[model samples]
Target: MEILQSAAALQAQTEKWRREGQRIGLVPTMGALHDGHLRLVQAAAAENDVVVVSIFVNPTQFNNPDDFRLYPRLPEADAALLGPAGCTALFLPSVEEMYPEQSKLRFDFGSLEQVMEGAHRPGHFNGVATVVSKLFHLSRPHRAYFGQKDLQQVAIIRQLVADLSFDLELITFPTVREADGLAMSSRNRRLSVEARKKAPQLYKALQLGVRLLEENRPVASVKNEVLQFLAMEEAITLEYFEIADARTLQTVEELTQPQEVALCIAAWLAEVRLIDNLLISAKSL
Candidate 1:
């Protein structure tokens, strides 16, 4: 696979591919190269003639300095994996290469970002939107791949594309999981052995919430049920247990019959914060 390090190099190579009329796909990732990320690359490979995977651990996205400092970077190993995943190019840019200086500009998605993940992570999506916007502009791919592990991120990116009118498709892949069913994430590495063992409970709790909703339980009771279960777990501290409209993400009171509800939960297993979610059928209520 070709390695493009600088912005100019990425632009030049992408331009060459564009001149040749080759379809290009881009997978933006903060490296450490897990099955989750490779999944996105493989999906991109199937649909596009060429795929470029950008591996830059963006500093702006981290709310905690230690977390940013502790983030993993393994470019050589990542590049080797990309080659097998049908990636044509891998962009390994330095922090300065991405942003020589910190950017003063910021973007706001109104209420779409000011609750749940956004509520807890101040200025997090701004960093995400900014860097993603930059990557989309740099690679100019026909499509970009993102995993659904970060559901709110998908929501935010979908809004960004529509509001800014970017000429690219955003395809979200299903959340990759461990054998025991913890959602795959770059941060999963940060969990201690004890924490990892308890982590799958997040997904298990989500499953319970799904069951309650499917059984036609009242929205209030279902939410309370999930919250109670989450609270019962000594290791898992609940952040938000919400039942909201599928589209607007606004919290709903009643099921109101056949409706789509998003059951989202965020919690902390000690310092390792994790989010898991499920879509529920309104008929259960």
Candidate 2:
């Protein structure tokens, strides 16, 4: 696979592809290859004639400077995995390449940016939107693939696409997990062995939420059960657990007959912060 490290190089290749009428797919990710990310690449490759995977750990998205500093970067290993995973090209850009000037731009997603991850990490989504916009412009893919693990991120990006009128399909795949059910993530590498074992509890708690919602329990009760479940785990501290509307992401008080809702949770285990969510449909609820 050809590795395009600069925006000009990516645009030149993709522009040539577009002229030849080749269908293109873009999978945007932060470098630190894991099965989860490879899954995105595979899915993108399956549907499009040409696939471009952008690997750049965006500094703007990190709320904590330390977290940014600690984020993983394994370019060689990442490229190795992508070569065999059907990736046609890799868009590996640098911070300076992406942000040539000191960018003061910010994007607001209204209520979508007001809760859960957004509430905790100020300017996180703005940074996400900014970089994603840059990637979308640079790659100019026919479609973009993302995982369901970042439910809120998917939501935010969906909004960004619509508001900006980007002519591309947005595809979301299921969250890839380990055999033990821990959601695969770049940050998972930093987890202590014991913390890794405890990590699955987040998914387990999400499972409890799904069951409670299926039984038509009150939304608050379902949220409380998941919160209490996380609370009982000494090693994992609950950040926030909310049963929010799938579209608006506003926390709900009661089920009110099972509309589309998501059970989103975030927690801290040792130095790793993990987030997971389960989507509940009206038929299931």
Candidate 3:
């Protein structure tokens, strides 16, 4: 696989690929490659003739600079992980290359980005949209792959494609998990052994909430039950637990018709903040 560090090189190489008529696929990542990220690349490999994985820790996407600085960068290890996925090229651009001048323009994604992660992280998704929009334009892939772990992000990107009319396809995979059910994440490394053990409760609570919803219980009642479970655990401090409209992400209010919905949560398990979610039809009850 080829490793490209410069934008000019990426453009020139992609131009060559375009001339050769090979379809391109782009996988954007924050560069701590794990099973989940590779899963995305694996999907990209299957769909397109050539897969391009862009490994840039977009500083714009992080509201916490310390967290951004603490993020792991194992480029050599990451490259090895991509080998099995058949990643043909890597677009490894520097931050300056991504943001030459300080970005003055920002995208307002309306209500779609205002709740869930957006509310918690503040200007986080604006940073996400800016860099993603840039990557979409730079790589100009026929299709881009993102993981379903970031459900709110998926909504924003889908809207971005429709509103901007970017000539591309967006593919998503289910949130991956550990054998014991903790969702896979690069930050999983930072968890102490004890926190790691308690981490799976996030998913367990989500599943329990789903069961309660299916029984036609009130949403607030179900949410409280799940909160009680987490509170009993002591180690888990709930940040936000939301059961909302899957599309607009507004509160379900009364679980209106039989539409699909998401139950999303963010919390601190000890010192490590973990996020996870589950999706089910509102009428599944």
Candidate 4:
């Protein structure tokens, strides 16, 4: 696979591909490749003639500077994994190349940015939108792929596409998970052995919440039960456990109507924060 680090080189290459009538697919990521990330690349490859995966640990997206500094980086390993997974190009740009000048613009998604991740991590989605918008422009792909692991992020990007009129199809695959059910993430690498063992509890808690909701239980009761369950796990510090409309991500108090609902949770597994969610349809319940 071609490893590109400069904007000019990437744009030129993509332009050449465009001139040659090749369908392009873009998968934006922050390095530290795992099966989940590769799944996105494979999905992109299946439908497009060329798949471009961009790996730049976007500094703006991190609410905690320590989180930004501690985020994993494994370019060589990531490239090795991507090349065999059908990636055609890797846009591994440095922070300076990506943000040649300080950004003065900020994005506000109204109600969408007022809950869950947005509420917990202030200005997080703005940074996400900024970098994702940059990737969408730079790659100029016919389609872009993302994992459902980042449920809220997927929702935000969907809105970003509609609001900004970006000409690309957004495809999201199911969240990939480990054998024990922890959602696969780059941050998973930082988990200590004990912490990793307890990490699956997040997924377990989501499962429990889903069961209760599916049984027609009250939203408030389900949340309380889930919270109590997590509290029993001494290593896990719960941040937020929300049941919300899957599309708008607005917190819901009841599942009285047939609609898609997301059971999203964020918690600290020791020092590393982990997030997971389950999407269920009230109709099915």
What TM-scores do the predictions have? 0.95, 0.97, 0.97, 0.99
- Number of clashing pairs per prediction, in order: 2, 0, 0, 0
Top TM-score model = 4
What RMSD, rounded to one decimal, does every model reach? 1.5, 1.1, 1.1, 0.7
C-alpha lDDT values of all predictions: 0.87, 0.90, 0.88, 0.94
lDDT: worst 10-residue window of model 2: 252-261
Instruction: Report the Cα lDDT for candidate 2.
Output: 0.90
Cα error, candidate 3, residue 70 (Å) = 1.1
Q: Which ten residues in a row have the lowest lDDT in candidate 3?
A: 249-258
Residue 46 local lDDT, model 2: 87
Compare candidates 2 and 4 on TM-score and give the better one. 4
Candidate 3: where is the Cα deviation over 4 Å?
Answer: none
lDDT of 3: 0.88
Candidate 1's TM-score: 0.95
lDDT of 2 at 2: 98
